[model samples]
Target: MTSPDEDRRTGAVHAVAAYGLWGMLPLYFVTLAPAGSLEILGCRILFSVVVAAILIRWQHGWGRMRTALRDRRVMLTLAAAAALIFVNWLTYITAATSGHVVETSLGYFINPIVTVLLGVVVLRERLRPLQWAAIGVSALAIVVLVVAYGQVPVIALTLAFSFGLYGLLKRQVSGRVDGLSGLAIETILLIPAAGLLIAVVSSWGQLTLLDHGPVHFALLAFSGIATLVPLLFFAGAAKRLPLAHLGLFQYLAPILQLLTGVLILHEPMPATRWIGFAIVWLAVFMLVADVLIVGRRGRA
Candidate 1:
């Protein structure tokens, strides 16, 4: 058997790799801009279905997939998760490709807080005082953004809430299905709608599928790998590591995304926006500290 320390070390590597890949997703979305967000979303769904199906086959999860398919409640939960993730994908792609990558990063920065709130309100989980303080500080950051920007940070909030809800729903059904099988089922559920939408886009002149030539077509197909591979790394990490460690590493993606936006992408960040982000960062720090403290206390 693998030693616990070795497993944790391996998990940390996988988690970092997963988040690093996710952080670079904005760069990937930039290349797909000609395809339009909806078209890219559709292609992502279709190709992800193919990729996830193959993974499920390799994992010998076909039997589990069939069982999950037969279960009404699990199907319903996955359907909800699928809808939320679709919204997340479309929004992030649109935001990133439209030069709103900074705001997109903000959404992810606030996502953990949103997830914690969902746990409290929807799942009836209790939180420590520091966690509540973190939530309050995060809310203040949102208000600051609204006042400073003269509009609510809708992109960030939408991304945060949609993904938080997606995670919550996935957690609910996590015990029932493995990651590949669940993802395969969810993508399979999306196929009909995605197919119809793609057909409609093709009927219009806007579809970039064949118009962009073979290279673009290849990129569209390769979206399957882009979508599934990081998730596979995350699944591996979750299996090998403690949840607390995994949770801490989740911040890496947003940090890299923020850097990509401000540094590499040349997105403007005014003083006010920077202040709001700083406050949000402080909130995240507090939340993380609380988690660490609580974990230590429990161990003691």
Candidate 2:
């Protein structure tokens, strides 16, 4: 067995790797934009399903898969999560392609606050003062974003709510369905819908992959591995790290996204955006602080 220190280090690596891969997702999505949002989303589901199937089979997950599907509630929950995640993927790709990566980043930065609210509302849980403060700050950020953009930050808010609901659904899933098996179920649940979409696209001569060359083909393969590897790492981390610490590391992805949009993509941002980002960041800080403090008190 691994020593405590070794296990901690390993968990940290896995968590960092998982978030880092996610941080680089915009680059992968950018290459596929030529294919259209629907096609990209469909392909992601198709590819993710295939890869997850192979991994699950390799890990002797057939029995587990059968057991999970037998439960109607679990099946329904997974289906709901699949739909939410698909929406999240489509919106994210569209945002990146439209030069709104900065706004997309805002979604993630505010997700934790959203999650806290979800707990209070859906889970009927109570929150401490710090949690309420975080929620208020996050709400302030959205207001600032709307004022700055002269319209709603629709994409960012969509991403946040969809993902928040996805997590909420996942919480009700009976057992840990996170790694290969969990991901497999989510993808497999969507395969039928994705297959229909792909078939329609193919019939219309609009299936972009059929016409792509070596480079595009290579990127598509990379996307599959890239998607799976981080999920596996996250699964590993989830088993080893405290949930509170894991929550803190989740911010890394949005931080990278914001940096990429501003520095690499050269996306424009006005004064109100700065104010919005500031509020969002402050909210996340409070959320993390609350989690850590609660965790420490429990330990004490």
Candidate 3:
């Protein structure tokens, strides 16, 4: 058996690599510009299915995949999760490519908070005082963004809720479904729709893969790799780390994404948006601190 310390160290390494890759994804999406979001999404599904099939085969995960498919409940749950993830992917790609990188970053930053809220409502999980306070602060931040923008932050909210729900469903079928196998199943479920999309896009003469030359072709194919690698790392980490520790590392992706938006992409951060973001940061700090403090006390 692995020692706890060793497990945690390995988990941290995997988690960081996963989130770091995720954080850098905006740069990757930039390469797909001018490709319609739906088109790109179709390509993602198609190529991801291919990659996942290879992974499942290589890892000898077909047994698990077969088991999951045979189980009606698992299939139903993964189907829902697949739909949610598709929405999340579409929204994220649209946001990143449409100059909403900052909003995309903010969406991920808010996801953990949304997950916590989902746990409260869906799982009947209890929250400590600090957790409640964190949620309240996060709510305040959203209100501020709404008031300042004179509209709701739809991009951020959609990403958060969709992904949060996906996570919730995945939690229900956790050990029953292996990550690579589950991904393969989801992409396989989406492949028909993806094929339909490609045909439609091809008829419209707007398929980037058709006219954008070899570079575009390669990038589109690379989308599968981009999608799968981080997932593998995240799964490796989750298996080894405590939930609290894993939760702590989740912030890395968003923080890097936020910086990438502001510093690399040069997205505008107006004063009002900054204020709202500051409040959100405070909430995240509280949440992280709460987890750490409670974890320490439990250890004691």
Candidate 4:
């Protein structure tokens, strides 16, 4: 048997691998361009169903999936989750393809704050003083960004709230739903919509899946695998790591996305935008510090 330290080391590696894949997703989505965001989203959902099926068979999770499907509350919760994730995926794909990858990164950067806010509003949870301060700073950052862009950052807000709400829904059914089973259920629920979307896009002669050559077609077909692998890695990491440790790893993706947007994609980042992001980063630091302090106190 492995020692605790060894398990932690392994979990850290899995966490890095998961977040690294997520961070590089902007690059992957960029390669799928000329394919419309809706089409890509549809195909991703379609393919993910296949991959989830294979995983269900491999892991013998059909029983759990069946149980989850039979429960009215679970199905309702997952249905909402499916819709929220659909929105999040579509928005992220659009942003990545439309030169707003940096803003997308910002959305994820503030997701923890949004999650906390949702807890306060939806769950009636109380926040510590630091959490309140972080939220206030995050709000200020958004105001700064609105001024810098001369409009609300719709893409970022959409991604943040959609994902935050998705997490909330998932949490409701967490006890009954394993990661693979939950994803499989969500994808299954989305299959009809995904099919209709593909049909509509094809009817318009805008479908690029076949026109993009073999490599691109293959990439589109394998979108399901791309979606599933990182999630599996994340599940592995979650099983071995503390929630706080996993929370820290969640920031890796957006940081890489921000770097990719600025360095590799060469998207314009003006001084005002930088100032807004700096404020968000400051809020993030405060949030992290609060988590650490609370964790230490709990341990004490």
Error of 1 at 250 (Å): 0.5
In the range 219-286, model 3's lDDT, one tens digit per residue, is 88899999999999999999999999899888898888888889989988889999999999999999
Give the range where candidate 4 is weakest over 10 consecutive residues by summed lDDT. Answer: 29-38
Q: State, as a TM-score between 0 and 1, how close model 2 is to the true structure.
A: 0.95
What TM-score does each of the candidates earn? Answer: 0.97, 0.95, 0.96, 0.98
TM-score of 3: 0.96
Question: What's the residue-level lDDT of 138 in candidate 3?
Answer: 99
Candidate 2 off by > 4 Å = 174-178
Worst 10 residues of 3 by lDDT: 29-38
Residue 206, candidate 3: C-alpha displacement in angstroms? 0.8
Alpha-carbon local distance difference test for all models: 0.91, 0.83, 0.91, 0.95
Candidate 1's TM-score: 0.97
* Model 2 agreement with the true structure over 136-242: per-residue lDDT tens digits: 88888888888999999888889989999988998887474544766688888788888887788788788877678877766665666777889889889888888
Regions more than 4 Å wrong, model 4 = none
lDDT of model 3 at residue 99?
A: 81
Tell me which of candidates 3 and 4 scores higher on TM-score: 4
Model 2: weakest 10-residue lDDT segment is: 174-183
Candidate order by TM-score, highest to lowest? 4, 1, 3, 2
